[model samples]
Structures are given as C-alpha cells and as structure tokens.
Target: MQCRIISIGNELLIGDTVNTNASWLGNVLTEVGIDVTHIYTIGDDLATMKDILSEALSATDLIITTGGLGPTHDDITKRAVTELFDCELVLEDSVLDFIKKVFKKRNIPFSKSNYHQAEVPDCCEVLFNTHGTAPGMWFDRGSVKLAVLPGVPHEMKHLVNEKVIPKVRAINGDTEFRRSHYITTAGIGESTLSDEVVGSLVDVLPEHVSVAYLPSPQGTRIRISAYGSSDDEIDERIAPVRDHIKQKAEKYIIGEGKDLNLAKAVGDLLVEHEMLISVAESCTGGYLANAITDVPGSSRYLMGGLVAYANQVKENQLGVSTDDLNSHGAVSKPVALQMAKGVAKQLGADIGVSTTGIAGPSGGTEEKPVGTVWIGFWNQDEHFAIKAHFTNDRQINKERSGAVALEMVRRSIMGIKEMPYGFKKYPA
Candidate 1:
C-alpha cells in the first residue's frame, strides 16, 4: 500500500524540536510492506493542516499524521480532521473517566484542559492510548484510511504497534506485499560501490528483486527488495543475487540492516572468539574506547583504555619514543604502531586499538593538513597502521577514525591478512 506521513507541529518547522515521528512511522510502514511516498511537515496552523491532509488523502491509500494532538488550543489536528470529514467533536465519557482515574491514582488535580483531550471526531473510531491521555483517532474516507496519533514518541509507538497496525492489516487483508533485506557496507566510497554493483550485478538480478544504494557519512547500505511474491518465493529469488553481491563486496560489507556500527560489530566478533582488547587514544580522545564499551557486556572483551592527548602522556603511558615523536611527529604511522603494540603488551590484552591524528580546525602543516588520522591495531605477532585523510568536520573525522579502528580490530579477529589502502604492517 502507498502511504504518506504528515508531521504537525510549529516547533518542528522552527527547529525547536526534531521531527523524529516521521522517520519512525516511515520505517514502521515500510516493515509492513507499505511504500511511503512523501512526508509532509506542517506548522500548527489549521489551514496548512487541512490543505496537507486534503492533498495526502487524494494521493495515498494510507494517510498518517502525528503531533498537535495534545489538549492545548494550538493542537488543531483533530479539529482539522473533523472539518475535513464533516463531523462534530464529541466528548467521549470513557476516555474522560480513564483520564480522571489516572489523575486520581497519581493524586493530581484533573483540570478542564484535561477534559478537552477526550474530545474526538464523532465519525472516527477511537484507539486507546494506554501510555498517555491523548487518544488516537482513525477515520475512513472513501478508500483511504487516515490515522491521527500523538506526538509523544512512547505513546505514538504503543498505539501504532498495539492498535493501528492490526487495523491496517485487517483492511489490507490478503493483498500481496514486498519484503526487503538490508546489507550495510563501509570502508568504500558510495560512487565506487555503486559503479561496481551496477556494472556487474544489474543484469544478473531477477526481475522480482532489485537493489538500492543508500549513502550517509558512515557508509553505504545496499537494500535488496523483492516484490509480487510470497516470502519463500522472494527469498528463493533473491538468495543467489544476495550471495553474489556478498561475494563481490565481501571485504567492504560489515553488517546487515541498521546493524552496521563498527564498534558493536567488532565487539561481537571479539566476544564470539573470546578475546580481550585495550586501547590507547590520542586525537580521537578515547572515542574508540567509548564506542567499544558502549555495547552491552563489553566488559567481557574491552579491558580499558587511555587517552594520551599530551606528548608526555604518550611517552609515559603508551611508551611512544620521544625521539620518534620529534622526528616524524605524533600522527606518524610508527608512533601509531608503537602506541598499539605498547598498550596490548602493557595491558596483557589479546588485541590493542589506537588512534592518533590532527582532527582539526587548526594544528595542521603544509604536508599533513587537517583531518590526518592514523589508526593502529596490534595482535600478538605484529602491528598494523592505517592513515586516513578525511576532509569532513572535526567531529566527523573523529567518528571516522573510531569506526576505522574498530573495523581494523574486526579484520584482525577474522584473520584477514591484507589491509585497505593507507594501511601498512609493522613487525612485532
């Protein structure tokens, strides 16, 4: 089914609040085999809400709106919907009773403003909101279905999962829908990966299955969507193509779907293999260690880390040679390798990861300009260093360095020999 999402709030338009509702709803609809064609964000103005709703109903099979459902006067979603459907606002006694009981249990005074929350369009079906006071409303206009949900994330999620989705499924009945699987890849540029996939695999993929490349600063994700077939049929059709793509991009492919964080992926690999890791960070300032330990049960694998920001700390803590630092600078590959191997040996860990660089708005030279990062990983036998020259903002450069360090750890754990470009091996 085709769907359109409308997020209603003046705060969203003014950047006072994030419109996370649209992203969440779009993902939910897509999971249920519905195609979200457009997303509209409108201020709390009644005319804008009405116009967007009218346009959405005419164009899409399902119209979902979020926000502006509170008891305040500026909350005009229900009023606009009622006007559009030619219905009158009726106070629901049951909802009012629930609200009163909730307030009574909490020992709080229930005001007249709270009563306005129970007022709904007379023609629409009320969907109970167990988490909050605002109730969801569902209206059927000809062949199109419209659902109005509260802006609160928790309340909207509960209503959609418990009530809205079941109703949508019942309406959809036995209509066939497509299913897609996402494979996330990193360490390769989007244009390069796209060129390779389109040139090689386009002709081999079946008519029922297709691939789409989604790019962000982190990496590119490949989504394999299958249409007009049963689940088993779709799997059968896409399995070979999926396998072929995996073979083509095996080195770059990290994890599946939204499961592609480098730290988490590497941590899982370490846990599976039963290994411990330590870190020594410079320019990244313990970001690599923080990312690794952010995953639950990371204590099992992540021993600890040190942020050796000053050159003296690097010499004292990680044992980086002062002579080396003075000769080749702190961001050099030799210093990176020494930092990695020294930390692993000192902490008695199976692996050590390190990052040293100038993630800079300043502190750059003519040869080594801003965003010069050297990531290092050390196993028992040897150390490896990768030099990355990123041109993004400082925060993004740090993030990229952390991700690449974790990827190096993953590669080491998997016994992958060759490192990517800008990486070199050093003897133990």
Candidate 2:
C-alpha cells in the first residue's frame, strides 16, 4: 500500500512551525508495510487544501492530513474536506459534550468557536481523540482512506497509533507486514561504513530484503528491513544481511537497536568489564561526561569528571604542566595525555578519557587550526592520544569529539586495534 502525507499550515511553509507530523506518520505507516511516496505542505487556503486532498486520494491508497483543525477562525481543514466530499458539517453531540467537559474541567469559558472542534463532515467517521478537543476524522472512499488529525504533535501521534493504524490493519488484513532491525555503529563515517566496512548489501541480502543507512551526530545506524507474512519468515529473510554486516563491521558495530546511543554502549561495556571511568574535558566542556552520564545506571561505571576549561584549572586540577600549556597552547598531545592520567589518578578510576581542542569559529592558530582535536585515553597498561580534525562549527565539533571519546573507550575495551576514522594513534 502507498501513503501520502499532507501538511496543511501556512506556518510550516513560512518556517514558523516544523512539519514533524509528516515524518512521524511516514515512519509509522512504513513500519506497517505501507510505502510513503510523497509529502505535501501547503497553506490553509481552502481551494488548495481541497485540490491537494483530491489529488492525494486519487493517487494514493491512504491520505493523512494534519493541521488546520482548531477552534480558530483560520482553521479550514474540516470545511475544505466537507466541500471536497460535497457533504454538510454535522455537530457530534458526544464530541460537543466532551469539549465542554474539557473546558469546564480546565475552568475556562467555552466560546461559540469551540463548537467547530466537534463538527465534522457527515460523510466521515469521528476518530475520538481523548488527548485534545479536536476529534480526528476518518473518511473511507472505497479503496482510499483519509485521516484528518489535529496539528498538535502528541494528539496526532495518539490518533495515528490508536485509531488510524488499527483501522488500516483491519482494512488490509491480508497484506504482508514489514519490520526493520537496526544495527548501530560508532567511530565511522557514513561513506566508510557503507563502502568499506559493510560493502555491497545488495550482494548479501536475499530477495525482499533491503538496507538503509541513517547517519546522525552520534553514529550511523543500518536499518535492515524485511517483509513477510509471519515473524519467522521476516527473521529468516533478514538474518543473512544482519550476519554479513556484523561479520564485516564487528569492530565498529556498537550494538543493535535504533534508540541505542554511543555513550550507552560504552557504559554497558565498562560495566561488563567492571571498570570505572573519569573524564577531563577542555574544548568539549564536559560534553563527554554529559553524554556518558546520560545513560541510566551509568553511576555503576562512571566516576566524577572535570571541565578543566581554563589553563589554571588544567594545570591545578588535572595537574597538567604549565610549561606544556604555554608551549603547546592547551590543544596538543602533551596536555591531553597529562589530563587523562591526572583525572584517572585523582578519581581513582581504572580508565580515563580526555578531550582538548580548538572547537570554534575563532581562537585558531597557524599551527593548530579550529577543529583540531586531541583525544587521550589512559589505563594501567595503555596510554595514547589520537589527533582528529573535525568541522568549523563549534557545537558539531563538541558532539563529534564526545562521540570519538566514547567510541575510543568502546574500541579499547573491546580490544580493537584500529583507531576511529583509521587515524594514527600517537603515544602520549
């Protein structure tokens, strides 16, 4: 089945409001074996809404629309839909009562415009929305189904998951269900992971199996998806691709699951090894520590961390030599090495990580330009620092540095010899 999502709001086109509802619906619909072909974002003009709705209904099996469903005067989705279907607006007494009760419970006066929230086209069925006053409407025109939802994200999600999906499943009971399994990897770029690490998924995947690489600031996640009549059938179809990816990129692969973060992966590994870790951050400003502690139960393996932003703090707290700070200007290998070792000794942890860099649009020298980052790792047996050049964006540099630091911990604990991005590891 094919789906089309229509976002009706001038705010979206003008960039005042983001159309997150379309992306959410697309993901939800695709997981149920429905292919989302196109997304339409238009103003609240009644003619444009009607035209787009008509076109979408004719071309797609399912059409879902969000926005323009409020008590305000400019709200026009219900009117446009009614005009398209050549139907009259009818007040739903139950919906009206619910809206009144909601206003009463909130101790707000219900106005005449509030009645518009309860009115729907007589041709459509009301999908009761307990989350808000605006009821979602469902229209079935033989082969095509149209769901009209409110602009509020939480309300839209509630209706789609609770009402629209069940209706879609009931209608397409015989359709094959599709599911995706995610394999997440850290410390690798998307191109390297795609072309070098896990090469030619087409060759390894069986029939009806496909792969997609989703890259973010944290890491790259490979989505292995398959469609089948049963769970076993889907698993059998997806196993070969999953296994091949694991075999080729085992060193870089952090874990499986779309929601997995690199910090969480590192925290899990530290716990497994019964190791405690501390951080001394300079350019990243404790971002690495924040990322690590973002994981639940991180206290099991996380020791305290230090920001060490100023030169005095680095010298006094982390015990970096003032000579090195003056000679190397705080963004070099020697300072990074001392910071890691000092943090470990101060916190009495088994492992320590440190980040020092010029993460900025300014404060760059001829020797050490912006995004020149030094990540240091220290343990009883191993001590080294890796030099990496990232982006000019300050926030991006911070995120990438934190990711590299966590990935360094993961790779070191797993005994992977290769450095992140295959950059050479220098002895501290």
Candidate 3:
C-alpha cells in the first residue's frame, strides 16, 4: 500500500519544532510494507490544511496527518477535515466523559475547550485517545483511508500502535510484507564503506532485495530491505546479500539489529572479556560516558567516568601531568594519554578511554584547528592515542569523537590492529 504523511504546524515550517512525526510514521508504515511516497509539512491554516489534505487524500491510498489537534482556535486540522468531508462536528459522550474524568482527577474544571476537543466529524470513526485529550479521527472517504493523529510524539506513537495498526493490518490482508535487517557501522565514512569495504551490491543483491546506507551523527546504519509474501520468504531471499556484506565488512560491523550502536557493541565485548572500563572526557563532556552507560546492564562493565573539562580537574582528579599541560596544552596527545591511564588507575578498571578535543564554532588555532580531537586508550597490553579532525559543528564533532573512541575500543578488544578509518595512532 502507498502512504503519504501530512505534518501540520507552523512550528515545523518555521524550524521551531522538527517534523519528527512524519519520519516516525514513515518508519512504522514502511515496516508494515506500505510505501511512503510523500511527506507534507504545512502550517495550521484551515484553507491550506483542507487544500493539502484534499490533494493528499487523492494522491495516496493511506493518508496520515499529525498536529493542529488542540484546544486552541489556531488548531484547525479537525475543522478542515470536517469541511472536506462535508460533515458537522458532534461531541462524543464517551470521549467527553473520559476527558472530564481526567480533568477531575487533575482537579481542573472541564471547560468549553475540553468539550470542543471531544467533538469529532460526524462522518468519521472516533479514535478515542486514552492518553491525551485530543481524539484521533479516522475517515474512510471513498477509496482513501485517512487517520488524523495528535502531533505530540508519544501520544501519536501510542495511537498509531494501538488504533491505527490493527485497522491497517486488517486492510493489508495478504499483501506484500517487507523485512529489513540493519547492519550498523561506526568510524568509517559512508563512501569508503560502500566503495572499498562492502563494494557494489549489483551482482549479489537480488532483483528486489536492496541496501540503504543511512549516515548519522555517531555512525552508519545499512538497511537491507526485501519484499515477499511472508517474512520467512523475505528473510530467505535477503540471506545471500546480507551474508555477503557481513563477510566483507566483518571487522567494521558493530553488530546486527536496527538499534545496535558502538557503545552497546563495545559493552558486550567488555562483558565477554570480563573487563571493566572507565572514561575521562574533556571536549566531549561526558558524552562518551553517557553513551556507554546508556546500554542496559552497563553497571556490569562500567566503572563510571570523570568529566575533566578544566586543566585543574584533569591534573587533580584524572592525575594529568602539570608539566604536560604546561608544555603540550590541554587538547594534546600526552594529556589524553595521561587522562586515560590515570582514570584506569584511579577507578581500578581493566581498561580506560579518554577524549580531549576542540569541539567548537570558535577557539581554533592556526596549528591546532577546531575539531582536532585526541582519543586515548589504555589497557594492560597497549596504550595509544589517535588524533583526528572532524567538522566545525560542535555537536557533530562531539558525537564523532565519541564514536571514534568506541569503535577503536571495539577493534582493540576484538584484536584488530588498524585504528578506525585508518587513523595513525600516537603512542607514548
């Protein structure tokens, strides 16, 4: 089935709020074998909503809209939808009762706005939202299946999972199903991964089975997609290409699953090797530590971390050399190395990792530019630091630095000698 997402809000257009709803909906629909062809982001204007929604309803079999469902007068998605279908707004008693009870529990009076929220177009089926006040509406207008959901991410997600999915599945009856496997990789550029490591998929990939390289701030996710009558058939069809890619990119591959990340993969390795790890973060400001601890059961291998941002903290807490700080500056390889070794010693960890960098829109020198990062690693066998140059964007630099650190840790644990992206290691 074909789908189109209409994200309604001025906030999205004006860059105040991101259109995450459309992307989330697209992912959900695509997983269920629907091809999401168009995404429209419009303001809360009634005429624009009606026009765009009308065009969308005509364009696709399944039309999903988010936002503009609120108590305020600026919210006009419901009104526009009602106008398009030539239906009068009518209050749903069950919906009103639910809202009133919710308000009573919160000790707030049920006002006219709340009553207005309970009203839905007379022609459409009311998709009662148990979590929020705004009622989701489903319209079956001629050949189109339209579902209007709340713009709030959690609420929209809830409604989509509960109300919309079942109806979609029932309507989907015996249609083509899609199965996708996500192979995540870090510390490698997308071009190098595709051109050098994995190479072309033209010969290995079957007619419909394909791969998509999705690059992110931290890493790359290669999604292998296939369509078949059943998931089993799809998996069977996708096996050849998936296995080939896996074999080719064995060392670079973090792990399987759509959500597998560098930290999680490294955490698994630490557990398997019966080792504990600690971090001393500078420019990344505990980002590396946060990533590591974000994984479930991280306490098993993590010995906590120190955000040694200041030179004094690095000297005092992480036990960096005061002479090294004076001679080589805070973002130097020696400082990074000292921080790693000191953290391991201080925390009594089997391994320690440290990051020092200039993640900035400013504070760059002629010799040491912005995005210059030194990632240090220390263990019983080896201790080394790698210098890398990332983008000027502070957030991206921080993320990339963390990713590089984790990938190197993964490689080191796995006994691979080459640093991530073939960066030269500066060892003391």
Q: Which candidate wins on TM-score?
A: 3
lDDT of 3 by residue, 1-428 (tens): 89989999899999999888888888888878899999999888888988988788778899999999989888888889888889899989999999999999999988898789998999999998998999899998768899999999998999999999899989999888787899998878899999999998888889778899999877788999998888788988889988999999988888899878888999999999999999999999989988988999999999989999999999999889999999999999999999999999999999999999999989999888999999999999999999999999999999999999888889888899989888999987
Candidate 1, after superposition: displacement of residue 253 in Å? 3.0
Estimate, for each residue in 33-114, the C-alpha lDDT of model 2 and write its tens digit: 8899999999989999988988898898999999999999789999999889999999999999999999999999999999
lDDT, candidate 1, 161-205, per-residue tens: 998889888987766567778888766777788776434675678
Alpha-carbon deviation at 378 in model 3, angstroms: 0.9
CA RMSD per model (angstroms): 2.5, 2.3, 1.4
Worst 10 residues of 3 by lDDT: 51-60
Candidate order by decreasing lDDT: 2, 3, 1
Error of 2 at 192 (Å): 2.9
Please tell me which predicted candidate would have the highest lDDT against the true structure: 2
Ordered list by TM-score, greatest first: 3, 2, 1
Please, what is the TM-score per model?
Answer: 0.90, 0.92, 0.97
Candidates' C-alpha lDDT: 0.84, 0.91, 0.91
Give the clashing pairs for model 1.
Answer: none
TM-score of 1: 0.90
